[model samples]
Target: MEKLKEVHVSRDEKEAMLSEAMGQWWLGAIGTMMKTMGPEATMKAYGPTMRQIGRDRASRFIKEKGYKGHDVMATASVIRIWEKMMGIEGQFLEASTGRVVFRNTKCPLSGTVPQARPSLEYAM
Candidate 1:
């Protein structure tokens, strides 16, 4: 096996890299599954598994981050961070007092949706 070289990146760069890697992994998994198992099988097998993974990730994030309280603003902030890290281009709006709304105009996952994988598209 070849030894890996160490590389350095800033915190923001690291977050962006991780986000891109995750997006690639998600889409790649779906494509691979769809190719090997057909769309139906991919939907049936991969969809639920993906949903579970997301749920588990969120749970772990909450636990590890030690986030407290049920503040909607806090939740929105967390979501915004995640979205930024995921390379999602969007805007957050202050619709009213104590109301924060996020509108995603561009998503890394959207471009891949037209390739005929409903499971992947919907999951995105």
Candidate 2:
């Protein structure tokens, strides 16, 4: 009989795995919903819920980061943090008091579920 070696995963690796799994699950679920319910109906049903989730996450992020102001820079900083967390490859074209522009080159959710794109774009 052969003995198996123990394997360990680092926290960062675990987080990445979890993030990828969640993204895949969301894409699959949304794709299914869009197919069954139609885009408009699916959006109508889930749009407000998604907005609330975003607001809640933003609030928690601000609190956790101890962000003082809701200024453009602060918002941009939070966005940058989110991009990194989500494994999104992107560049900030401009981040100013008046504007914050970002171009995403790669997304964690991209190319995973093509049918979900149209519905997910609205949520995004």
Candidate 3:
């Protein structure tokens, strides 16, 4: 008989692992979709769906967080927070009443799914 050593994982480590697994799953699923449906068809199908999902999520976030203002800065703040939580590295070049500008340096999904960049950009 062989003894197995106990291994402990911290919460942050578990979250990182889960996030990585999700990114892999997303890459696989998107790649499969692009292959089977073709990029144009995939974008046509996924674009609206993802936009709706984003809208729903934003609505929920606003409601849950009791967010009031709907100005550009307010929206930017929410997006910035959400991106940080998703482990997206970015710099906000400008966020004002008129506009919000963000420059993404690193994205978990982008590096792994270069072929699906068009579809991803369409979704965003």
Cα-lDDT of candidate 1? 0.70
Candidate 3 per-residue lDDT, tens place, 1-124, comes to 9999989999999999998888678778888998888888887877788899788988998789888888888878877776787677878788779999999898766666566656656655
Better of 1 and 3 by TM-score: 3
Q: Score every model by TM-score.
A: 0.56, 0.75, 0.73
lDDT against the true structure, per candidate, is: 0.70, 0.77, 0.79
Model 2 misplaced stretches (Cα beyond 4 Å): 1-16, 115-124
Q: Which ten residues in a row have the lowest lDDT in candidate 3?
A: 115-124
Poorest 10 consecutive residues by lDDT, candidate 2: 115-124
- Per-residue C-alpha lDDT of model 1 across residues 14-116, encoded as one tens digit per residue: 9878877876776787777777888877777767876787668667878999876457776676666666765778776664447887777877657674443
Better of 1 and 2 by lDDT: 2
- Give lDDT tens digits, candidate 2, residues 7-123: 899999998899778877887888888788888888898889888887899888768877777888877787677667667787889979989888889875676655565654564
Best candidate (score: lDDT): 3
**Which pairs of residues clash in candidate 1, taking residues 3 or more apart in a chain or in different chains?**
none
Residue 36 in model 2: shift from native, Å? 2.0
By TM-score, rank the candidates, best first: 2, 3, 1
